[model samples]
Target chain A: MGSLDTRRLIVCRHGERCDFCFSTHRFHWLDKAIDEAGRYQPFNLNLPRNLPKRRGGYDSFRHDTPLTEMGYLQAKLIGRAFRDREIKPHHVFVSPSLRCIQTAIGILKGMNENHTKLHIEPGLFEWMRFCRNVAPSWLTVDECLAAGYPVYQDYIPVVKETELNMNESLIDFYDRSHLVSKTLLSRYPTGNLLFVAHGATLDTCTRQLCGEAPRSNEEFFEIVQKTPYLSSIEARQTGAEQFEIIGTPVPPLAHSANAAYDSQYLTTPGYANNTDTL
Target chain B: MGSLDTRRLIVCRHGERCDFCFSTHRFHWLDKAIDEAGRYQPFNLNLPRNLPKRRGGYDSFRHDTPLTEMGYLQAKLIGRAFRDREIKPHHVFVSPSLRCIQTAIGILKGMNENHTKLHIEPGLFEWMRFCRNVAPSWLTVDECLAAGYPVYQDYIPVVKETELNMNESLIDFYDRSHLVSKTLLSRYPTGNLLFVAHGATLDTCTRQLCGEAPRSNEEFFEIVQKTPYLSSIEARQTGAEQFEIIGTPVPPLAHSANAAYDSQYLTTPGYANNTDTL
Candidate 1:
């Protein structure tokens, strides 16, 4: 094999705040609704509010938002996991989104690997959430019922509407997100590949790779079972033409009491149990 | 207009260097071929072949690859131009490509503009030129004939081959380049917009805005002529949702040639032209 041939694909979803700290913050209720409906049923629902008063609307402030405290720990765990396994990546592929970029930077920092080349691709951005300040609220119980119950089956449709209302869609996000991994795989085939992406993108990408039926965003998180973290799919390139998924592993973290303390500050609570105490 | 609307788009191409300087020096003959043909055509053609050697390649040496003396001068010119026009951009978009990035930094250095929010978007990258080490002399006249004539019509095919042979393509480049502008436009409708991009992307974008057919890579330089160092396109958002191209204007230099020389290096032809003179 050529010295430059890529050997392994190391995939990592970007850390957590990206999921919770959207522009409108109104999506918190929507996320809660989905979480309450259980992980199997998908349901579409409109956001109760219009655009947040942010600059980029929902997508604004992406560049300045840092990883939450939980996010930092998640990255550190992934870095340690790689170190424990003695894995060294030749190149790093990252989403330009602030959360993913920060996660990639943090993971590398934790591992003390400073010199790897990081290529930021926009295709890895998270699914778009349409936010309008004027979006009508579901004030009455009947209005809530008309809005439809949040079912796992309705997740895709709801996310699609959210994107459309916001002028950005999950399908488009998935399509573009896949391009990020595809570009990385095609360009740097045999290397430990790490993709710091949003939860929705990571969910969609993993399902596509794992060949599962479309999963709701909530169920997608269940596949990894960690909040504000990284998930890995170990794939071996058999030749220049093929890739074989060898294992999908979510590295275990050393539980600490502080984990719970950090979780309390997140915009969304109860997503994960934080047994760790300060 | 909304208080946050982007009133203008400031587009500028990267600075100058010889092909050898950009790692593209090996294709001097191809550049020469295009330039020769451009003289007879209505459009201008001034492609710089400043390709740098592969990073860490055996032949790579510690030669100074910093911006040239002309490049610095060009950057200052752009800065002064912005200042003179009293242009203040809310957002600055830059191509992640080295030359364009450096150019953006240089120009920003001279202006009073805030640099805290500059974004390096990879989507704004120029047309990709794959390196093929084969000598032009080795190819026969017949091979040149097989490659087709040096008209704008034939340029895209050859450029495509050059990129594909090296795993890059103009089509992908054009699409990606356009994505940067589109993304920025969606977010910043009425602020002053600054884009530091490649000559090719700027050219294609300029042509597209002017309602011309997509020009070939060689012809791109024609539509967007290069200045002594800097070239610019000024555009304004009009009619609520449309952008109207103003004009391509060159930035004025702050210091005259004599004053600039007096302020900096001791002027001499060889020394002034030497990139290492810095």
Candidate 2:
């Protein structure tokens, strides 16, 4: 009704991954709460953390984790859903992470809309980690192009390996993620858009577009913990300053994927399916 | 390990409600997207908005809306979870809204711990709304005490119906919620603490604790849309300047109920859920 300052931002969490994990990283305050509680042995969290990562536990690593067969299917499902609705995004922006690239490819194939180009936006990459060892290693533009996805030629890599500069806190991530909307709103004020990124991005963008308050670290942990692959939020502008949730249509991946389904996904580089794992 | 500045702000979203709605409030950009192709069609959102008491769709009002049976059970489950873990919150803070009051009661009863008191905090109330038509009608201290929950003796009411003073914008809410941590960190510096309030409180408190950046107007909508009832987040102080998510252990609400289940909740007190709607 008003001028076209309104838009839709369909934010997607990349499909499942071997390294993009929550199972083993299950949070335990007992280790950190000791300092925050300002008391010792106040209570025991008894977090069954290491148990999930031990001998019978899973061996998880960071970066370049490929999607399981299930992950590809999940992405494809989202793509197919888009096609069924005849909703073709004006522009699709993707995080350059391995999983995101794969998910984006799956979505394109499913949509079967060859017209819209994929823009490799590193700005939508995973939250900048303070822990140097766990920081993301994004795919280069050249590599992404070689992988055969149509990447925006002008896209520049925002994240750098040598730079340890980061927003180590969820607050920092919130700030960065919050900015993504400002940029998106300004760049494409009246078009339906899609963002394929990580759990944090999904949480931040979805929360932001829905007019919800920023999340606390505690809330964030829970949000990311259950962010199943393909989980998404649909935002359609109701007014210049208002938007509405069309829905969250993440078809269930597997009822027991978190604990039951753990198919081995490729972990190393130069693999056949580079789009789904890095 | 670190100094007293360390803290874990566990934030909780109040339970389900008939009014915490998303139906009918569906979204739209225009009626159609002409694209760079600029065409137009009347795309109706088909929202099933309630027709009651509407001059033209906005007869917004606010008061205490009690929790459904399921909501009560959900809160109780969270309390029971804390008790089972021997996790005792040294201090518990509650928003003055009725649902929050009810939820705080449920959690306390389930905790089965008698030492602490429920602080009826207005600072933790919903971001102040400037629209007089939608101002919150909080239960009087006398009314709350009569309801049988332990009301903080020193607690003072902050929001006034006659006064226009309030934090109505997301920026305002963010600033106020951030201050909540400053006050808590200053006063309770070292102890397990709990915050019980609405979806906005959950989002603001959690984001603030995790040290997230300020939110713009666009980011706020998506955040509020899918705030699941009984949803929660756990914060763990990793160091004075660092915190981690321990986990979100709120068991599924439908899983069970406590022996002390009370069905005749105060749902008809010239009140509806004041929160969410505003």
* Best candidate (score: TM-score): 2
Fnat per model, in the order shown: 0.00, 0.00
Best by lDDT: 2
Model 1 C-alpha lDDT per residue in residues B94-126, reported as the tens digit of each score? 654445655776677657554434465545555
Worst 10 residues of 2 chain B by lDDT: B256-265
Error of 1 at A57 (Å): 57
Candidate 2 residue lDDT tens string, A1-278? 22444466778877655333322355432343234443332121111111111121122223454454345545776787677566667768887666787788888887887766787775676767734556555556665566566777885434334532454566666656666765776676767878898866766765665577767666666556555567676667777766666655332232121111101111112222222211
Q: After superposition, how far is residue A195 of candidate 1 from its true place, in Å?
A: 62
User: DockQ for the candidate 1 complex?
Assistant: 0.01
Candidate 1 residue lDDT tens string, A177-203: 555556666665445666666545544
Off by over 4 Å in 1: A1-278, B1-6, B18-65, B130-171, B209-212, B216-218, B224-228, B249-278
C-alpha lDDT of residue B8 in model 2: 54
For candidate 2, write residues B1-278 as lDDT tens digits: 22344345666767644233211255222222123443332121111111112122121212344554345545766687778766667778887776787788878887887656787777777766623446566666665666566878775434333432444667777777767755775577777778888666655765655566665555454344434455566667766655555546443221111111011111122222222210
